[model samples]
Structures are given as C-alpha cells and as structure tokens.
Target: MFSFSRSPYMTALFSFGVFLLFIFLQNTVIYTSLQTVFSTGGLCACKKCVMDLNDDDWFFMRFNPTVPALLNRRNSAMRSDVFTWWKGLQSDPKKANFSDVVDVLFSLFPDEEHHVVTDPNRCRTCAVVGNSGNILGSHYGQLIDSHNFVIRINKGPTKGYETDVGSKTTHRIMYPESAVDLDNSTHLVLLPFKIKDMLWLISVFTTKHVTSTYTRVRPSINAVREKVMIIHPAFIKYVYESWLRKHGSYPSTGFITLIFALHICDQVSVFGFGAKRDGNWHHYFDNSLAHFSRGLHRGDYESRTIHELLLMDKIALHKGV
Candidate 1:
C-alpha cells in the first residue's frame, strides 16, 4: 500500500486543482451547448461571440426611422411609408397625425452624423427577450445578459424574475401605451403606432403639451436622451409586407423587435416569445391569458415564420423551458 500524508499545503493545492478542473469542465459544457445550437451544419461558431460593433459590420445601415425608406412613388401609394397624415388616420394607422407635425422630429434626436457605425466586425450579438410565460423557469438570464445587446420588449419585468428575464436592458421596444420606465442607460425605443405617438414623444421633452391620446402617457420619460430610437415607419411596413407576409394588418411589437435585431445585430438570439403551457398566450409578468387577433395579427403564422428563420440560420430562438 502507498503511504500518503495530508499536509495543509497539499490540501490547499488539491482544492485549487479541483476548482480549476471544475471551471474547465463548466466552460467546456457551455461551449458544447452553444456549438450544438449554433453550429448545426458547420456554420461558423464565431457568430456566437458577444463583441462590440466594428467597421466591417457596417453593412447594417443605421436606419433613420424618422423618414420613409421610399419617399416618392412608394409614399404616394402607401402613406405608411412615412406614416404621414395621408394614410387613413383612424383605420389601422392606429391613430392620426396632421402634416404640420413635421420638421421638428429631426430636432428631437441626436445629429444624423452621429448615427453611422464606427466599429466593425466587433461580432455584435443581440438577445431579443419577450414576455412569454414559458420563460418562467428557464434560467436564461445569464445567457441573455452574455450578449453585447439585450433588447427587451414593453413591460417585461426583470425585477423578481431575473432568473428568467436577464436583469439588463440595452434596449426596450414600446409605443405610447405600452411604455415603461427605463434606467438611464437603457435605450427607450419608440415604436410609433400612429402620428400622435411621434408627436407625443417629442412633446415629452419640449412642451409636455401632448399627454393623453388613445390612452394616458407620461408627458416626460426617464431615459438617456441620446439613446432614444424611433422605429422608422418604412421598416414597419417592410416587416409587414416581407416577413409577416400580410398575415396581419400589422406586426406585433415582439415580431417587429425581432426583425429589428436582425438588422442591427450580426448574431441574434430570441427568448420568451410564442405561447406556453397548453397553447396559452400569456405574459411572464402577468397571469392573464391573451389571444392575438386573426384579423390584426396571425400569431400562428408568426410562430411558423420564426421557426423558418431558425432553420435558415437567421436567428437562434430559445423556445424556453
């Protein structure tokens, strides 16, 4: 039999070795899991890295949502191109806005020159987190927070639910009604549902003159002034026509935010979207089961589209636990 002595130094060294081994094993498992999801057919795994946006990735034109993508013929045909007053104000444009509420929109944001992407190939990764109740037990917080940009939607709460929804918010997508308070670091992305929504946003800082529209809204909001982003009406229409394929009159805030991720992020991971626990459409923050309108939006169709995007290697969708 081999004789062994238990010295304090030896004990300490052994413990340290064991700790190192544990860390190595943990990292290996994480790598393997990410590889399995991201590298399904020899796709480059580097896309999984959470790096900053660099110059080469400048293929993503920082969209100016203030103006329409197509200004001339397209705008005339579909007023939603710019969400101008010409569009049926009450019918599906959500709300109405007059033509006079213009020229001032540009003044509300940072200079257009500051909008271009300076860093490239930083391997930008973004996580678009939704409010699906399926995320309740999914410990996706750490994974979601690992990304360079974490985009949360509307009122998806991180408090008391950090395990499911990561306690970070680089961006939050909302309209006037669905708006929620944000940390000074978070970007308050306004998805204008109508003309009044745009006016209301500007009014928040300048006049505080426009408050209640279709519903009550904060005359002023708490957010980093420089970080505010408006979803271009043209982009919304593009999502409606190209991706959603006219499945609904308009895309849901969740779906629009997902498409937005595809534009700005090199690698996108989606979490807490779709239905949960017996095909019920419910929010993680609330227990109330809801349903999407077949006329307004085809939730079933959107789900299918998301699956297709996953297969095409466009995005990684975490269907949740």
Candidate 2:
C-alpha cells in the first residue's frame, strides 16, 4: 500500500488547484448554469471571479418572440447585397445561392420537401391563427384545432381560450423576442430580424448542441428538422417598398405573419382578426372586464389587407373558422 500523508495547508492547496481545473474544463456548463445564477448561485460571484458569458446572450436570442425568422437565406448574399445597396456593388449569386428563395403556394407544399437535403414527413393541413385577445372566451379554440395542424402565434394560450378556440394546437410559433414557455409540442418559430439572429440560428442548428443553454424551461430545440425556411431579404424589402408606395408602413406583425401563413397552409380561415369592438385597440389588456374582454384590433390597414385576402379566396370569414 502506498503511504499518503500531507500537511493541512498542502491538502488545501491541492484541492484549490483541482477546483480551478474543473471550472475551466466545464466552461460550457458554467455558462449555461449562469442563467439561473443570479437566481442560481444564491450569491453573486466576486468581480474577479466573474468571466464573460458570451453564450448567454446567444442563447437568450433563441427565445426572442418578436419579429421572428420564418425564413433563412439562400446564402449570405441576401444581406450582403442589401447592405451594399450601391448599383454597381450588386453581385450575382452563385448557382447554389440562386434558389435562396422560391415562391410556393401553400396548396402545393410537399410533405417530405426539404430544399437543402431531405425533409421529414410532416402533416399536410396547417393553420396559423393570431389571437388579439379579441376572441378570448369566444370558444374558437376547438375550432382552431380542427385542422390537421394548427399554428398559433404570440399571446396564444389555449388553457383559458379552449372553450372558444379549441385546445388542439399543433405548433406554437414564436421568436426569441416574443417567446413564451407553454406546455405543448411547440416549435420555436425563429423569425430573424437582425443579422445576429440569423447567425445564431445557423450556428445553433448546425452545431447541434444536445444540451444548449438556449432554453431550460423548455428542452433542447426539437422539431428543428423542419430547418430554416429561406426568406429573401429582397422579398421583405419588396413588400415594404410596395407597402410604402400604397400605404406608408410595412405590414403589421400579424398581417406579415398571415402572409407567411397563406404561403404555408392549404386551406385558411381567420377568426378574431379584427377588433370585436372598434376604436379601443388595447381592449383585452386594458379593459376592466375579466371574462368577456376582446383584445386589441391590429390596425385598419392589416384588416383591409386581410379583407383583400378573404376576397381572393385565400382565407375564410369569421365564425368557427
């Protein structure tokens, strides 16, 4: 047997050295653990002990719910071209990048279509509904869930709205800016606004971190097999330019989301899109009524656009639709 004896001071020094090595080796774990740290550590780290947690910033961006990314890129050229708006600076995309965006009507979408490689088998019928809180207690929840796949956006909670809407939600769409944790097989609908979000999505999905700090209240990103659907920055710019020419501002978030839905769902029906009561847009959040409160009206412009969609057979009118 080997004899092992040491002074208390020497043992203490050895323990300290081992602890330091452990911290350095487990940096990723430390980084993720820091989310609940302010709430996790029970006490703040010393100024000298604090290390830069660059990953936290990136992880939080994953849950951003406002203005999320329903589209990815053909390549990085979309941004590069837009950034260098100079006439002569325009550069043609390589053949590979050319297919960055392709217009596909929702009616023709394939079940196993993956533009890059191969896509998974997904449901055929899909629906994306926007809740203005205008339909709270309207009992549309069940009706909303009647489709093969139901998609819900921000402020969509089925528990309370089940009576009116139906509780069948196939996918809950959102972004890091507007993400809310819910109990369902909700896909974190990433709608990237800035270049950073796109970069983060590219990195996260590709790196494939099994235990990413991206979320804890939720599990590591599932249903990501859908991959990033490339949306052309040009398309966004084109839509906005057209809108400015006609109206003045770009489509509201709900309408923008609706346009995206129109391109993805086969049969579409809209309920509670317009305000139940006029003028008071901020009704649900502001109104004093508890059970019968209808939420805010998005705006007249979006309603007009939605109406145009209705006329074109793109969407059905209100009432259990």
Candidate 3:
C-alpha cells in the first residue's frame, strides 16, 4: 500500500545504512574472536608467538643463569648445577655412599652434543599422559598415538587398557622405585629422588651391584642404554621455585613431566591431569585408591597452575573423560 520514490538522495541514504550495518557485523565478529582468544589463555589465533617463546632455547636463556638450569647431556653448566642440586638435597654421605656414587652417576652420561631433533620440518607434538582415573573411559588411545611423542609417567600401563590409554610410549618417566620394564625404542627417563636412585639406574644397565636404595629396586631393567636419559636435579628445583612458586617442598613427577614436555616439544597436550569438580584423585588403572595427598606436593595449587595455563593457552589440558 505504500511505496517510496526512487530518488537519487533516497537511494544514497539506503546504501549508506547498508554499509554501516556491514561494518558493525564485521566488528562484532572480530570482537567475538578476540574474546575467545583472551578467555582461553590470551593466545593469538593466527600465530602462537607465545608458544614460540617457550622453546628450549628460551628455557636455556631464561633459567640458565638462575637456579635449576635446564639439563641436557651436553651443557657443562647444567651438569654442574645438577651435581650441586643433588649434593644439597641428598642426606649426609655417612647415611649413604654418595661420595663414590657421583662418580658412577657421571659415567653413565657420556660427553656428547645432544639435540632433540635433526630435521628442520620436525614439528614435535607431544602428549603428556597422566594416571588419573578420569581417563578410564576416555578412549583416548587412538588420539594419543597420533602424537609424535607420547610420554607416560611412573607405572601408567597400556597393556590391557589399550582401548582407553594408548599403547604408544616414546618416553617413560620413573624413579628407581617406580621403574617399569620399557621397550627398546622407548626412552627411559630416570627421575632420581636421591643419590641411591641414580645408582639404581646405573646398576640396572651394567651390574646389579648398587641394589638397595630407600627401598629395593629391580636388579636390572630391559631398556636400551642409548635411550636412557636422566632428569636433572636442577631442573626439578627450577620447577619448584619458578613454576609451582614453592607451593610444596617439591613438585610432583607428573607436574615436572608436563614442564619437561614444554621445553622439548613444539606442541604439548596433557591428558588425565587433576580431578573432577567433586575432587577425587585416583589412578585410571585402579579405582580403589583416592585422594592425592597435599603434604608432599600442593596438589590443589598445582591444579590451579594447570588451569591458569589452560586459560592462558600455554598448554592444552584434556581434564575429563
């Protein structure tokens, strides 16, 4: 019943209104994208400059001068730092033969330039899998195997539970007490608690001479000497001082493994970390056990740090089943 005249001025006004609407829509989309990036850890969607800054070189540069220098087979400074860290943390030599133990420990680590990668195109994607009960029905095996590097902590097994937890393990982290029999291909990363733990690792390969530590360890292990790696004591101290902010006397091995992945890998994804909102801590393989003790390591504080990292987009945490 009503029609506007097709005048030049009227047409121009309509075109101007349409133009403003388009601009408003564009701005709205941009705002929404920015909100997502900021909400989930302020990551730049286009290029992860923050991730680039978290490379091994960055770690070496930032913490090399400070306590807990990044440990590698080659770095003399890191070797010295790790040695001192072990000396300071261990009990009196009278209690244990730590004086001669250092000599044996140093023998296992050869003097060679160790590099994590050789290929320029090697974009290492690492999955740091924990032993939390949440991963029981996750069916993350295929997802986990897809990663370039799959790191498992302590006694987390994938034999029977291969449907949920992947069978692939590039690296297995353990102390002497928690040591598991690893395949030849999988790297055995020794996370020593004391001088005796280090001695236990050395004995595992060569001789069953140094057996008893705080507890009895396996007489020998079945892992390749070429694939054996020792975690630096200084690096452990660094995780305590720098990352967890001295939340507890020391950081948990799982937490340390997560940080270690960040240094070595280009892309890091974490699985089976923390509990549900109900706050129950149990291993995936066993449901009988519950509640992670806060006395040794501040489990709650470490969980908070992980959440903050998730929000900041430092690491991707898959928390639930």
Candidate maximizing TM-score: 3
TM-score, candidate 1, is 0.72
TM-score of each: 0.72, 0.51, 0.74
Give each model's whole-structure lDDT.
Answer: 0.69, 0.45, 0.71
**Residues 218-249, model 1: lDDT tens digits:** 78777776777776667777777677767767
Scored against the true structure, residue 160 in model 3 reaches a CA lDDT of: 97
Q: Give one digit per residue, the lDDT tens place, for model 2 in 52-100.
A: 2233343232221122123432223445554333112223231222222
Counting clashing residue pairs in each candidate, in order, gives 7, 35, 2
Q: Which of the two, 1 or 2, has more TM-score? A: 1
**Model 1: CA > 4 A from native:** 1-45, 48-86, 89-102, 113-120, 293-295
lDDT of each residue in 26-75, candidate 3, tens digit only: 85675555445333223322234223433333232222222322334334
Better of 1 and 2 by lDDT: 1
| Candidates ranked by TM-score | 3, 1, 2
